[model samples]
Target chain A: PDPALDDAIRAVIDGKTKPLGALGRIETLAARLARLQGTTAPRMERCTLTIFAADHGIAAEGVSAFPQEVTVQMALNFLAGGAAANVFARTLGVQLRVVDAGMAEPVDHPALVQRRMGPGTANSAVAPAMSPETLAEALASGRALGADGDADACAFGEMGIANTSAATLVIHKLSGLPIATLTGRGTGLDDAGLSAKRAVLERAAARTGALPPEAALAEYGGFEIAMMAGAMIGAAQARRAVIVDGFIATAAAMAAQAIAPGCEAAFVFAHRSDEAGHAAALEHLGARPLLDLNLRLGEGTGALLAWPLLRAAAAMMTDMASFESAGVAGKT
Target chain B: PDPALDDAIRAVIDGKTKPLGALGRIETLAARLARLQGTTAPRMERCTLTIFAADHGIAAEGVSAFPQEVTVQMALNFLAGGAAANVFARTLGVQLRVVDAGMAEPVDHPALVQRRMGPGTANSAVAPAMSPETLAEALASGRALGADGDADACAFGEMGIANTSAATLVIHKLSGLPIATLTGRGTGLDDAGLSAKRAVLERAAARTGALPPEAALAEYGGFEIAMMAGAMIGAAQARRAVIVDGFIATAAAMAAQAIAPGCEAAFVFAHRSDEAGHAAALEHLGARPLLDLNLRLGEGTGALLAWPLLRAAAAMMTDMASFESAGVAGKT
Candidate 1:
């Protein structure tokens, strides 16, 4: 964090409010933003949601019961207004835009932003998957799309079958942690399937060279993860609140923070997902999620569930009557 | 729980919408109200929040670190707009009216409704708390106040130090459960305090006779709990959605349900509380709480936290485009 931003945040904390640190993380986030932007009253406007759609090469590994086609189907569901994400975004009054960074088929949705870097990468078990150029393009696409939204803040969500495997690989590579620590049964995988996922990830890591801050990302990262990382960096530069979803989004956020350390100031962990890896990711990010519903659907549902709390937090900051104004005595 | 109201709720579940049970408890509540009042739309308007304030005699038991005076002080703070509940009510655009059902000291806030039935109850450890006449008057006062609000829906909140013991006793009597099973460390009480609280409740129950339902309430209940029960019943007679808060409100709800079986149609359990007996109370009432944050700090904080989710559920019911309207195919 910048010293000036840190100072500004402390000043806001010391401001004449109801009580010092009564608002919890909401107050902390607001204060940090105040310092970052050099404004006492930092407002959240132009809220944008980036739904990255990709096809995990690991889906071809038979690790998922749901076929790879479910990825495209769900992405279409998102665009055609049938998915839970659609209902949630509608309720939150936030704009939703889809990105086809590496879907298996040719993108057709008019609403979806066609930012494909490849048809899909090779299976990570066999090789280093995506090339550096493809990775760079995916990152650039995320940055460009985030910029296009002119978003005050952005949330990172994904739709990709077998993507949890990809997320595991990314997390393991980034954190220098073993695959066993970060791996989980994605979408109800059995114990055997989990073991298979761990083995696949370990082999993929061996094939890939020294994790090049960004190189490991290209080798093991899904297009959606790379793009989300890019979007996070862009949103951070724009000084927007990056509301992160569950395990996959947290992994992307970790990668984003690695590339651009300043992005941590702009992120808020929306909820503690039921996914096992989620706790590790949140701990790694030093984030406190708003809700814990044991939810693991992973279609930005947890983030959307927490939108009301965010609204409440912001409302408290903006609407609550100060002690002086309400003619009430402060706690002694 | 009425046959007609149950049928109406069933009709709502069978309505032409998404899945048969997708909307969950929301559709049930709306439909039950429709049957009770014989209206299709079943609108919830003129929302009233009655915060019952009292001083717990248990404070004299050395159970609480804070004195009984804090209850009066906080009640005044609520009237003066210094409490968390005040900030929450203002933010949610709900009308909050405070009622001093039992306070040792008189508060001079002009906004506070002076409805004191007595100075305070005797400590429950020794004898019956309040006289039957006082309990009846408290109940009547609550009913009158609720009716005056013209509330299409009502929410019940309470403010009293160490009232958790009072609530625990109510829950034990109402649920016919053992005190040990329901007793919890109220407001960060130690294990020793909890055991002592259970002993106190058992001793109180042993002394108190099973007076008539209303008379029993008067004899054993606090002025605030009795008043809240009356308000809940009144709100039901007026065909309003009664959003019940945590443990204390649940205890009052149980009392209201006992008095007026039809009032069950008007009740909606807002959220599950962190209190040990809260779930038991909810189960006794067959109420499904919306949120379950391990929060035991009453003063309607749980209900306030759930207000946004309630709004979201309502918004989904009213605003989301149906499959036909959005021109989208439902998932097979």
Candidate 2:
């Protein structure tokens, strides 16, 4: 952390018209923005939301309510500017970038980033999900996306059917939380389907017991998850604010923290998910997300929702006149 | 709320690519916009924030950390567009109107909405705050502001130094909550200052116990508090989405609910205040604020912070292609 910048910005925020720390988390956000940008006048103007798309082989186990085809389709929707993330990003002027980390089928669109690691990862219930080479490729692709010079901040989202099951297993291994506690209604499963999902995920967790970071990525990580973890690392390294979305995104952030030491500094957890596992996941990371609107959609929608708060925090630091400048009296 | 429009708008929100209620509070906000506009295709293009500034007689009791003169000075700051509200409202394209509801000294500015009920209210610790006629005039003015035909929605905030004391007294009279629970650091009070303020408020509350809405307005309400409550009622009557700010604004909201029935339908609580009393105050209103940023600054900054969310919610309902149109598969 930039201690000098933190001290300078703290004085700036304190000298504002209102009470000390009266802006609450916004003051905290302002300090973080200053630390990340290495200046008190932090600008969050060229923000970007990058969605990594892939298929999870766990879908073959009937863990998701939607077909794996939905992954590519959602990516197409993002490219077509029809998803919730598109609406939110358009509102905040956040540039949208779609990366084809590893979809089952090849996608060729004007905006579709062609960085596929493979068709998809293998089912973790049966064997390790990805080869070491594929894991490295996905991580590199994410790193490339995260370091785009024009981007001052990045909102990382993913589109992969049955990826939540993969995330649950990965979190269970990484955080040592019980698989049952980490499981949730991915894509809105019913009682019977949830039971089936739990049974499958429990088996997958047992199969990939307590692997190291590389082996864990090779074991339970979907291509999009691995790529997102890489993107988080890349964003942090580039000193860009990393705005993570919902449950899957938080899991990816955890993975990124483990992969690249000291990368959590650039991160801002956007919102808490209604998914049962999300609160524990955020708590495990010792993160306090900006909003908790009960969002569970994956396309960086939560991060996009929180974009305004961050922008306002920076704006407050730069634009708002201090009590001395505005000639407003301090507390007697 | 228009039930027919509500049903149609729910269909529109549900038909989006995201899951049912996956957008959570945003879906609720979208439905509210549709209801307010009486159409599924609601527009939130022209938003307005009306900040009412007034002096409170409670300040004379030395209950506030700041002098009463700060109210008029902050009003001038708002007129000059140098305050936090100006910064946030400028960012969000929201029109700002600063109204001098009542202050001890006269303020002159081209942009100031000159509508003072009196120089200031009488000291509520010893006598009534405002005359019955003054209370009526303040409410009517607030109603007039709320019914501005050009504004699609209204964000009500206030800039009254020492108004938190007035608000605490009002809430104590209305909801009968313990005085200690509803009192908080107004503009940053030290330990001794807080203790002194509490003692003064307790005495003031003892002098005026269990007053009705009109009596409470006369006994405990500051001109700004009365006017804000009136604005809430006025906005709700005009079917405008009333975006309320932090602690004082929430207290005004409770006052509005007491005065006018069914106004809660058009109300949107902006964010939770870090004030100790604000959580219980919000709970009494049965309101779930859109954000929990812990903002205590009361220049409509919290409402402006939430403006993007409300606008995006409306935009999502209007601009985004439905799942049927996007050809995205729904949950099985």
Candidate number achieving the greatest TM-score relative to the actual structure: 2
DockQ of each: 0.17, 0.74
Clashing pairs in 1: none
Q: Tell me how much of the true interface, by contacts, candidate 1 captures.
A: 0.07
Tens digit of per-residue lDDT, candidate 1, span A1-332 = 46766765555444433335434455665565565555666555446677998887777777664567767767777777655567667756667878888899976867888888777777888876688988888888787776565666677788887788888888878887677878776666668877887787777778765585688788888899899889888888877778888888888898989998877887778778766687887887778786665656576666666665555555555555454555544332
Task: Give one digit per residue, the lDDT tens place, for model 2 in A277-329.
Answer: 99999999999999988788888999998888888888888998899998988
Question: In terms of docking quality, how is candidate 1 classified?
Answer: incorrect
State candidate 2's TM-score: 0.97
What is the model-wide C-alpha lDDT for candidate 1?
0.71
List, residue by residue over B7-125, the lDDT tens digit for candidate 2. Answer: 78888999998877888888889988788778998888778999999988778888877888888888888888878888888877888989989899988788888999988899888
Candidate 1 has a TM-score of 0.75
